[model samples]
Target: MVKDLYPSRVNETSQIVRRQDPVIHNENARTEGPLSAEEIDFYEENGYILLKSFFQGEELQKLKQELDSTMEDHQHKEGPDIIKEPSSNEIRSIFEVHKDKSYFENLSKDERLVSIMEQILGSQVYINQSRINFKPGFKGKEFYWHSDFETWHVEDGMPRMRALSCSIVLTDNYEYNGPLMLVPGSHKWYVQTAGETPDNNFESSLQKQEVGVPDEDSMRWLVDQAGGRIDRATGPAGSVLLFESNTMHGSAGNISPYPRSNVFFVYNSIENKLEQPFSGKEPRPEFLANRENIQPIQPVSNKSTARS
Candidate 1:
């Protein structure tokens, strides 16, 4: 049985537990990767780093096309993997995308992405989850503030905070368009929310999270720890935001004319494979968390190599 170092959603009162795991496991003794020493340091301090224009021109265009085409392919389909908006049929998110043999799968194994994931994880890694999230203009809804690690630990049996997410912006992330926002340095502490895990929580949680989210007091406390500031990741198309798993993040509703969309990937170290749920319930569906076929990604040498 895996020992639960970070316990959450078990107590009546929310507790602030100090993080036991390092934010960047392979901080030192690393050789080659895309991140500079300074950039790595920034990620260590802020719990996130934005790479502006990480994909551009041809690369960006191809990703956009693939995103549009994938959405079209799923338009008539319905499954546990596809989540729709609360009010309309507009798709909110499509999960487990890396499982498909599509452009997204290729992007997942691109050396540029895999190398950085390997460096931070200090070992071989595999996709914990992958999705293309969409927030359409006028109807886009808000995502409440919460720590992903809190949910993954209690519901999905993630043992530690050795995972991270990369959100590749597919459209201009304007301030008003519900771009990702996070409390800097929030990853240093784990906020134990007050709740018991509901059976099949992800079914409704994906539409509008009610149980695992941090309450108002906890949110204030987390922001205060970061000097009472919330940072928004507003950037042009092709920008990428890499954030730690425990980082408290969410986005506002998009009432602007432009829609917001991104291809998001979660990578977990092979050493931190999930165990039985800490919630004492059955694990979430395979579409939400993968325990089977957890294969390490083989990084390609270049974009052309990924194509091959």
Candidate 2:
């Protein structure tokens, strides 16, 4: 069974759910825009870029509300581990929580999300998968360094294709709160390891070692091979991190007292054909559902805020 990260919050069993609005940014706001050459260069060189307040405050609040409500219901059926309180153990596999039609409907109508995605991947980009990562204060464990593309693909034999995973922070993320650590430009060095399988093996290694220190030199070697380029993605709520499918990244453990949550949406390019179905479940039944939902993403806006 997956461990509960926030025992206090879940055990109390209060129905009170917090609600807030999505914060809209005034910086270069536009419904649709093409990515500039320099912005593309940054992604090519850095493997990932942090987009500030990508979702409005209200939208984020609504999603959070849905997550909380679903998690509350999940606790009753799946045990106390499902609705962990702040400073509890990490909870895993939250997909089973409240798979309601309204949840899918709300996600489908997220205009800003859809608009930004369309700009980055063209109009053909589709939603392949959606997941919520709930990490409670001090109880949340570290997510080991790796790439998403290394795990997901068409079940049938086929050539590897590019994909994208978009992560939106629902709470403030700092080093102590388990901010994401990325190896810049590592996407270009992606090489399929012969007979290697994707699983928690990598995470196990991370759990046994200290943060910023890898037990195996191979991890260091990989980053060094990428010209020693690395960066820790830390930001407040609403920050969005978009990375290529092959980008090497990981996160530290949450040592803070505040809970951390991030909702991930994976997308693919429509031009790249899949040999078989990408997900085990049927399509989302929404118009936006498509095969290209998890493919590598192109930037829609040429203008990018300078990294602070």
Candidate 3:
């Protein structure tokens, strides 16, 4: 699974919760522009919704430039944020964008995103973390099936799953490029796969334990019973995907000629701010678990952009 994501607080146990909920989308809501009421409802019901071609052109180009330059500048550097693939040595992901450059600073405060945050989360919210995931063309790695809320809850001291994440596509996300895949409506069911908590932070803990993956039998049962479906989030270079933190998501290794790249912004409701990490591990880097700069965003008033 992607390292920079939020994990669930699936406690020490082995149980697959069977939550029976039927989802029906409302086709009457406005189907254009930013999220409509019906669209938001769909997200609430299914755990995620892809906004096709939500961004484009210059904005995407600038993000690409910032990502490329940052990667180039940090080549060979060793740290938690600059993670590299084990086999190909390609950069798997770059973490904490709001720390490294101003280009990513405006992402959280953009009206386009923040307004929707207000609608789904509430009037008060702040960014939890940010990162750019790179699934390289030929050697992109696989992110095994797991739930993000389990990590945030158990490791990061997040009390509940009040946060959500958005993936802003920078490069075309195709099936062969290992686009993200998720089990439909799996957010409501949590599986406590193992009986141990991570000894350390989320990223390092992933190396130490399986974290939150359910047993194979349970997964098969959930896929068939929990709406019996999986979705591949594929779209053009400017698409945006908003997903609940607890959702089950994973991706296969990209052995294709095209690479998949996307910038992620995780927003947590101010009402659900994090407490100190409960895991007896050392404190996570600020980039991973932000605590210092907790300010309610002023997006609508700012009309912000990267250039501004």
Candidate 4:
């Protein structure tokens, strides 16, 4: 359901696109599984994997134009998931794009990503969420260090930690540009926090990435136990990172002159899917927790080039 895009050049369109299937076939890259055994091993042991120059040329360009439209449309609006920082036009995220737009929807369904999911989770995997996290220049807010699974498990009924966060860099990420920071191998230790989870809402989720911010002492202890090796993943625009959902990760506020943006997708195993919400209440909004469209993704080819 995308329009007027083919990978390069800035094209403008006012269209709400949809798609029938996910496409992994790339002209510049082969359709076979992209990750190596060593990479998989690293992801398993270190809790994250960063692949530089993962996608480029027309694909990146087309996605950027689509994001350009999204950023413009949702900057200060109120609807679905278009979340902005507390009192400003600076956006925090545009959630569940795969449900509405074709460009993001196709990328989320790409075979390259799903094949990796097949390796990590299983053959039957569906996306839990999809959104572009906007870390705008100068004024982007910070995300506290916490495990995503904590909130997913406690609030959204996710049963276990069998999920992963795959983030594709949209803008060049640098040390000074609010790069995502990860405490290596921190997923092994599930830290229990003292703080309470805020109510389920876009604002709450934006203000607090973690369900509960583990106290400083708790976070310090967890870091010490995890070997105290923190890694800030900084790379070019096309870099792709796959991180364990349980890994303790966060990013500082962006003070750089250029924006740091990424399209993030969370994939959860069908078998390790969410149980009922802990509150015994109805599940969260579909944009927040997608449990109904549990169908496994099927890989498709790019019927036409991404460029027009």
Candidate 5:
């Protein structure tokens, strides 16, 4: 059995656990992809990198079209994958996007993205999870601060921190639009939150997470460790934010008139395939944590017809 390096949701009191893995797996190697040595170093020191204008013009429009189609296709359908806002009917998120075998699947396989994943992870990677988050104006709910690795480790059986999330901006993400906020350098430490895993936690956690989150004290310490700096990932449409899996991040409720949306893809190294849940419960549904049909994606050329 693989040792659980980071444990959460098993204690009455929350504590900090130092990360045992490297943020950048292969720092010495020369990167053949888009990211430079300095960029890799930045991601190592901090937890995320916001690449502005990563996709613009026609390439970006295509993604937007796909996003629209996805929302429309599943607007009325009821399932665990389609999460709605707490107080409103607006769709909050659409999970298992890559499995849809549509434009999103192609986006996941694009060589530009896959190559970067391979570079940072230092191995072939597979889609651990994929989703599109929607935060409509005024009614969108806030996602509380928590490290994704914490939930994935305790609930979904992810074994290590060799994973990262890529958020492709589908709409303008202004500061007032509830853009993602991440604490710099917090990814180096894992926050073991207070709580025992309840049965079918994903059902409720998907809409509003109450468990597997850091306490106020833990959040304060993490912010102090980063010199009390929290970064708001604000950018125009077509920007991309790549963040570490263990990064402490969250977003506020959107009160602005503008809506915020983004496509999220989680890439996990093949070496870090999930096992039995560390929380001693059944694993989350495949839509949330994929266990079967897992295969490393090949890097292919960008297929968008219109060039930026």
Candidate 6:
């Protein structure tokens, strides 16, 4: 079934990757409920929302464990020096390693996450893509300011509409830790630049110098052009930032001692189709798999019965 999706791209010898179950068993943790009406309004208006303490305690620890294991697995096989330090160039292209069942299961089964996504993007959301971002200390690359959806549409021929992204901070994030930065409410303008590019360049330019590093003044000017509403998003471990794909955003290089890692899940309405496969290798099997396994948000039935 997976092979059929890639008419000309499939490698016959490539191993079949198993899909993860969409349920996680964490006895010590409780699920966080739906977002308040105010929270939903904030997301709709500003194009992003920082849910404080979104994941913590045991569940957070479990995710960290999984992240660590995944990192270690990659490091052992690829060698420690695969990523050198003190550069802000991020190591992109890590999907093969992220295809593990545990990673997908952990992300998909988060009840609170699904509830919040449903509230923001409706009940029939489809995960467009998922990948792990590893930003090594000092050596991590600086991601320039741009909209995720704009780059997607340009490169993959996808349309720009109703796209959403959820970034789960697997490690502690602060200004020095390469936390994501954004221009608040920039999604409303739908700005596009001539030479803007996506940050998915890992092997070729991952460690290369930024082609055009925007100076502070230039960055401020760009923010002003986008309406002068800029903000840096930083939070505790397990914090998640949900934003529209068109939100203008970027991240700095990690200046801290430790590497900053995060997992990004991009979702769009199921009816939306990608112009090309996310990885450019083959179509995601999950996109064609059983939709029942992927939980949909429960609809709100009665306003009168709703709790104040």
RMSD of each: 1.5, 13.7, 5.2, 12.1, 1.5, 11.7
What is candidate 3's lDDT per residue for 1-308, written digit by digit as tens? 12322333445556765433222122332443257777877787778999888777677777788778877777788887777766656676788886553667666677788766666664467888888877668766677887776676666666666778889988888777889998887877766566556554466643333655667876787688566788999999889999887788888888899988888899888866777655545656777777786888777432334436
Worst 10 residues of 6 by lDDT: 19-28
Tens-place lDDT per residue, model 4, 1-308, is 11211111112211112211122112222223466656766776678888997878888877788888888877667876777666765777888987764778888888777877877764457889999877779887687897777667666777666788999998888889889999887776665544344455434565665444555775777678667878999998988998987788988888779888788899887776666765344677888889885887785455255644
Better candidate number, 1 or 2, judged by lDDT: 1
Give the distance in Å from residue 169's predicted Cα in candidate 5 to where it truly belongs.
Answer: 0.7
Ranking by TM-score: 1, 5, 3, 4, 6, 2
lDDT of each: 0.88, 0.52, 0.71, 0.71, 0.88, 0.54
All candidates: TM-score: 0.97, 0.65, 0.84, 0.83, 0.96, 0.67
Candidate 2 vs. true structure, TM-score: 0.65
State model 3's lDDT. Answer: 0.71
lDDT of 1 by residue, 147-225 (tens): 9999999999999999999999999988888888999999999998898888999888988898888888888998999
lDDT of 1 at 231: 98
Cα deviation in Å at residue 115, candidate 2? 3.6
Tens digits of per-residue lDDT for model 6 on 1-308? 11222121122221212112111111211233276666666765677888877777776776678766665666534432244333433334344232355555446535556656655554456565666667767566677775665445544334435557788887777777777898876665543332333344323333452322233554465577657667777888788888887676887776678677777777665544455533343322332222234343333332222121
Regions more than 4 Å wrong, model 4: 1-33, 195-203, 209-211, 279-282
Of candidates 5 and 3, the better by TM-score: 5
Q: Which candidate would rank higher by TM-score, 4 or 6?
A: 4
A best-first ranking of the candidates according to their lDDT comes to 5, 1, 3, 4, 6, 2
**Comparison by lDDT, 2 against 5, better one:** 5
Q: Which scores better on TM-score, 1 or 6?
A: 1
At residue 12, candidate 6 shows an lDDT of 22
Comparing 3 and 6 by TM-score, which wins?
A: 3
